[model samples]
Every structure is written in C-alpha cells, then in structure tokens.
Target: MASTSARDDDGMKERLRQLGLRPTRQRVALAKLLASGGHRHLSAEDVYAEARRAGIQLAYTTVYNILHQFTAAGLLREVVVESGRTWFDTNTGPHLHVLDEESGHLQDVAIDPKALPLLNHLPLGDDVEIADVEVVVRVRRRNDSA
Candidate 1:
C-alpha cells in the first residue's frame, strides 16, 4: 500500500511534466489541494476560491487552465451536478460523487466493485474502462425552523 501511494505521487509529477506544466510552486500547491484532502470535488471556481483563501497567488484563469490540463491527463475527474455546476474531482479512481445540493459540497461515495460487469452490458466497446462514475444525489438542507 505504501509503495502504491508513492507510485501515485511520482505518477502525478510525471503527468504534470507531460502536460507541459512547469511543476512550479503553484502547480505543486494546486496538486496538493487536490491530493492531500483524501478526495476533493471542486469546480475550477471552487479551486480558485480556495487557492485565493490559502494565499496562493495564481490567478483564477491559471487555476482553471491547470485543472483542464489535469483532467485531460487523467489526474482529475470532471462532473456536472444537477445544478449545472461543473465540479472537478481530485479522486481520479473509480468512485461515485455525492453532491450536497444545499451546501454545494461534494463527497465520495463507495460502490460495489462487482457491479462493473453490469456496465459491460452497455453498448460501450471492450476497450472502455470506467474511470469515474459520478452519482450526484441532490438534497435540500432540513429547515430547523419547521
């Protein structure tokens, strides 16, 4: 498990380089924002907001471009919730995203691995491998006033 985690780190670094990103301080910070939090579900705007809050000097456009690069490189998963908000997920592995509609926060939900066979029944070709399965569950916060 430890070895696998180390490999993931190395792989991320390589991916940034391959994507033509300099892997500078800002890039590393951005990567950490995604990786360190276990799994994050954030839109480009969300990331930019957090970066600003964290005192990272990178512009919002820079964060957005970096996010697109990461998504293209398979380092992140892009999801659109029912609210029509685009969210970027730090967890690139197979998992489900649970969107908190009330708070606009997203969480990772566990799913049974056995169900993958059923997905194969779809029209997708044999070469297709599921990267991430986004299941945005919408709910409103309970009004305590009631």
Candidate 2:
C-alpha cells in the first residue's frame, strides 16, 4: 500500500479542508502523499516525483508552495539532514535523527527529555522554543553486515 497511489479514490478532500486548506486536486494529492500508507522523510524532489508518477499534474513550483504552506501551518517538519537536500517529515514530535553517512538515509532516534542537562546559563530571551534537538549520528555501514 505504501507504493500504491491512493490519492484519487480516497477521502483526502475532507482532510485538507480540516487543515484550513481548500481541497484542490493538487493539495489533495500532496496531502495524501504525505498522510497515507506510511510515514517518510521525504524531500521536495521525492514528493514531486511521486506526484508526477501518480499523474497529479502539478508544476514543481506548486509542489514547493504547498509544502511551504503545510510546514508553516505545522502539518510537517522540514529538516536539513544533508548538504543540498531538505527532508520533510509527517511526524511532528520532538526527536532526533540518525543519518547513515553511507546511504544518506535519515531515521528517527527518540531521546528522553530528562536525559538532557539543564542549560540555564545560556541566554534565550523568552522568544525561543526548543522545537527539535537533532543529533545527526553519522555512521558508516559495516562491510560484513550484508
């Protein structure tokens, strides 16, 4: 089901409307791509390719615009795990990421908030909310693992 495109026949319209976005074909298709089957750390290019393969008929600018809108509205989290690629995650919870240096894949690594030391010495003047603390643990894959 993850690979199958379920946008057209599914009830994606209602979902987008609930998020205060008008349910257009482009928005519905993008929303379904983000919501259904499985969660992923997708890049804009990844989303554009998927939408194109699904015959969603959207320009690259349209995809990027909708993604920015969704991120601004708190529907997605954008992370820069690598140089030149920004990843979008459907999961909004505070967490860290483990990026495989060899494969360039990003994976979530949950951390206990209590485990972190208090940083009261630093001056954060009431305007800062620590949304995410990402520790990109870069590791090379073992030769014998496969």
Candidate 3:
C-alpha cells in the first residue's frame, strides 16, 4: 500500500502534468504545500517560509518563479494590492476579497458579481471586453474610542 505522502505526491504530480507543467521535484514539493490546505492567499515570502518549515531547501527566487509559472498556467491567481506587493491565490474561481489594511492579510469573501452595479455598465470602447473582475475591499480595525 502506498503511504499517504506518496499518494499526495502522485496526485500533485498528476495535477501538474494536467496543467502542462513538468513535475520536477521542487515543483511537486511547492505544489503540494500550496494545495495541501484549503484555498488561501499567500505571498512569495510566505511560501518560502512554509517551504523552509517543511525542510524543502530552495531559493526565494525559485519559489517566485514557480509561483509566476503556476499563475500563467491558470493554476493560481495573482492579486496585486499595490506597487511591489502581490499575493497568489489558490482559488482561481470568481470571488471577492476582503483585505485587512493594517495586517496586509487577504480573506476570500462570497459576494455575487452581479450584485456589483459598476460591472453592469462600463465606459470602455466596444472593442474592449472585460476578461476578469477583481474586487478587493480594504478594511482596518475600528478605533472605538471616538
């Protein structure tokens, strides 16, 4: 009988293959880490830290490259909060996000895209089409002592 870790590695390998990405050792390790838990947003540094915790030795740039590669292959979604800051989301489906301004953390929120009135009408040229819509509502902790 195959061990649980072996089974997980095989699954990750198959997933990577299906995405047209070669399943290298490093890639498999990183993919497993990203997909192990439920979908969540993570930065490159976050992934690097996790990899270290898992005893996976690799450079930060390698993690960044693999993340970008995965994003290009549609396996992940890139969220840019501001200049020089980005997060990779495992949930590639259509969803909104609630960002904590103070902590720089991102949490997925369930809100129907149709409910957003701005998407109903856009002032773009007819030749233009919206590929995707990413809505991030930034919030901070309330200061109750007003």
Candidate 4:
C-alpha cells in the first residue's frame, strides 16, 4: 500500500504534467497542499503558512512563482477582489464570488451564467472581444441601528 504522501505526490505530478508544467519538488509540494482540502481561495501567504504548518521548507518567492505558473497553465484561477490583493482559486470554472468585507474571505456564488442579462449587452467594438468576466459581490455585517 502506498502512503498518503506518495499518492499525493504522484497525483500532483500527473496533474502538473497534464497542465504542461514541470512538477518540481516545490511545485509538487505546493500542489499537494492546495489540492488537499478540495477547492479553496488562497494567497501566497496563506500557502506559505500552510506549508510551514506541514513542515515543508520553501521560500515565499517559490510559492508565488509556482502560483503564477499554475495560473498560466490553467491549473488555477486568479481572483483579485482588492487592489494589491490576489487570491488563487482551485476551482477554475466560470462563476462569481462573494467577498466578506469584515473577514476578508471569499466564497463562491452559485448563479446561472445565462440568467445574467447584463453580460449580453457589453458595448465592445467589432475588433474587441471579451475574454472573461469576474464579478465579486462584497458584503459585511449589518449594524443594528435601523
């Protein structure tokens, strides 16, 4: 029987290969960490913290570089809800997100793409095309003043 770590490494290697990325040791380790908890939105700092908790030794720049590589390879999606703040999402599909203003966390918003009428009326020129749309709804706790 293969150990969990071995299985995870193999899985990460295969996934990276499919994405046309070389699965270096650091990449594999980071991929395993990102893949462990199903889908999530994580920053480089979040990943670095997780790696440290797991006793994995690597530099912060290594994590940041690997994250960008993964995003370029379509293995992850980059979500920027605020200026200078980015989150890497494991679920690389068409969907919207909800940002918690108080906690600074992101959650997936389930809505049919076709139901959005605004997307159908984008004012683009003939020479331009829309690549992707990212919508993040920000929310915070309401005060009891009212």
Candidate 5:
C-alpha cells in the first residue's frame, strides 16, 4: 500500500505547481516522502538513501538537484548545521531550531511571536531591508552517569 493516495498526489502536484515547478513523477515521489513525515529536516543524501530503500531508483545527484530546486522555489528551507552538513527543512515558515550534536538530530524550537528581537544598524545602502531570520541553538545530552 502506498502512503500517497490519489488526492494526496493531486495536492503534491498543486504544491509544485504553486512553486512554478513541473510536477513530474520524481518530484511527486520526493514531495510525498518529504511531506508524509510530520515535519522533517533531511539532507539530500538522506532522501536519496531512503528513496532507494523505498524502491525509487533515482540517482543521488537527482536528489540534490531536486532539493536545491525546492529550496530555491521557496518550497523548502535549508538549514546549515555546520560547514558541510545541510538539512532541507520541510517547514518554510519562520522558526528556530535546536540541534542535538550527539545524535545529529534537528528539531524545531517554538518561539514566541512577541519575543522576537529587533535587528538594527544598517551596513548596506538604503535599498536594503531584512526579510527573514533563522536561529539555530546547538545542544548536547547531559551525562547522567557518574
């Protein structure tokens, strides 16, 4: 049994259409994987591996390309946890993240809408304004054993 029903597939098509991307089979398959999970932060490699396991024979480069396309189209958010490690977050809205260093896990951290800090001081010309902000807090598990 496939996790995506016909209606769900149609919704996925609309999602891509809204992004001005063609709703190909590959895009729909990738979108289903990303959206089926509640809210996910997956690397391109993660998606490639999972797709292979799920019997989708797409190349790893294809996954990266699709992820980048989605990110550029505002369908996904890219969170850089470190120099080379990046996660494609399913949530595109403004939010914060708490990263577990030990397990390499990322989770969304709730932020109070009223508690957001105001950014001041401009280093750019008059035509510049801030549009979006991202904050990631890294954490580690506290050792319980003495």
Candidate 6:
C-alpha cells in the first residue's frame, strides 16, 4: 500500500509537470483524485464534492478555476453537453459521448470513424483549417411498457 501510494504521487507529479502546472497542494490533491482511478468524467461541482468528502478544503470557484486550467493545459478535455452543463474528461484523446438525460450520466461511445457523417463545406475563412469535431449523442433508455 505504501509503495502504491508513493508511485501514485510520483505519477501525479510527473503529469502535472508535463501539463506545465506547478502541482500545488490543492492541485496535487485534486489531480490524484481525477487521474488515479483510470479515466473518468466529472463536473466542477462533483469534483468539489469529492474534495469535501476527502477533507480537502477546496472552494467551488477554485475547483472551476483548476478544472479550466487543467483543460487549457491539455491535461483534461472539456465536454459541454449544453449551455450550462459541462464535464471534464480524463481522456484527452478525441472520442464521442452518450449522455443520459434522466440520469445526467455520460459514457464513452465507441464507433468507427468511417460510419460517421462527414462535415461538408465547412463555413470557414480561406486561411482556416478544420482540426477536430466533437460529437455528443443524447440518449435515454426506453421504458419497458412504452
């Protein structure tokens, strides 16, 4: 257990360094929670709640700021399902998501790129180039009686 804890700390430190973050006390604490247990999707409020549960004194605003910083640093990917709903994903690679409206839960959607609809005639400037596309499909479970 002790060795595992030490290894986790080392990994967190190295990850933060690569993202150009200073890895402060709060940052290290939050990063450990987010990056430790494999890939996860979390909102800023969820992150704050977890911090509080862990006895970490983190403010909501601070959580948002840290999440934004991590996203900007390329340590996390931001997924906005709607105007006010945003989630931070631990997986930085490009992928799709399926959001359950009733549960407000998001899960990864794995599909072949060839099956996806292509973006035709993008409205961009002459010097602009398309980089990536984010596809979010909202789904709800069908009721048995219906």
* Candidate 3: tens digits of C-alpha lDDT, residues 1-146: 99999998999899999999999999999998898867999999999999999999999999999999999989899999889989999999888999999988899987765468897687878898778888889999899999
Which of the two, 4 or 5, has more lDDT?
A: 4
Candidate 5 residue spans exceeding 4 A from truth: 1-4, 112-115, 118-128, 141-146
Ranking by TM-score: 3, 4, 5, 6, 2, 1
What stretches of model 4 exceed 4 Å from their correct place?
1-4, 124-131, 143-146
Q: What does the lDDT come to for candidate 4?
A: 0.88
Task: Give lDDT tens digits, candidate 1, residues 36-124.
Answer: 67777777877888888877889888899888878887778888775567888777666666667667777777774437566667786
Which pairs clash inside model 5?
Answer: none
- The per-residue C-alpha lDDT of model 5 at residue 141 equals 75
TM-score of each: 0.66, 0.72, 0.86, 0.85, 0.81, 0.79
On TM-score, who's better, 4 or 6? 4
Better of 3 and 5 by TM-score: 3
lDDT scores of the candidates, listed in order:
0.74, 0.76, 0.91, 0.88, 0.86, 0.84
Candidate 2, residue 101: lDDT: 81
Candidate 6 global CA lDDT score: 0.84
Top candidate (TM-score): 3
Would you give me the overall lDDT of model 2?
Answer: 0.76
Q: Write the number of the candidate with greater TM-score, choosing between 2 and 6.
A: 6
Off by over 4 Å in 3: 123-129, 141-146
**Considering only N, C-alpha and C atoms within 3 Å, which residue pairs clash in candidate 4?**
none
| lDDT per residue as tens, model 6, 13-79 | 8889988999887888888888765778998988999889888898899989999999999888899
Over 1-146, each residue of candidate 2 has an lDDT whose tens digit, in order, gives: 54334544256776666778788777877887788647579889888998888788899999999998888767888888667878888877766677888788898877754345764455667988665555556678679957
Judging by lDDT against the true structure, name the best candidate: 3
Candidate 2 stretches with Cα past 4 Å from truth are 1-18, 112-115, 118-132, 141-146
TM-score for predicted model 4 compared with the true structure: 0.85
Candidate 6, position 122, lDDT: 50
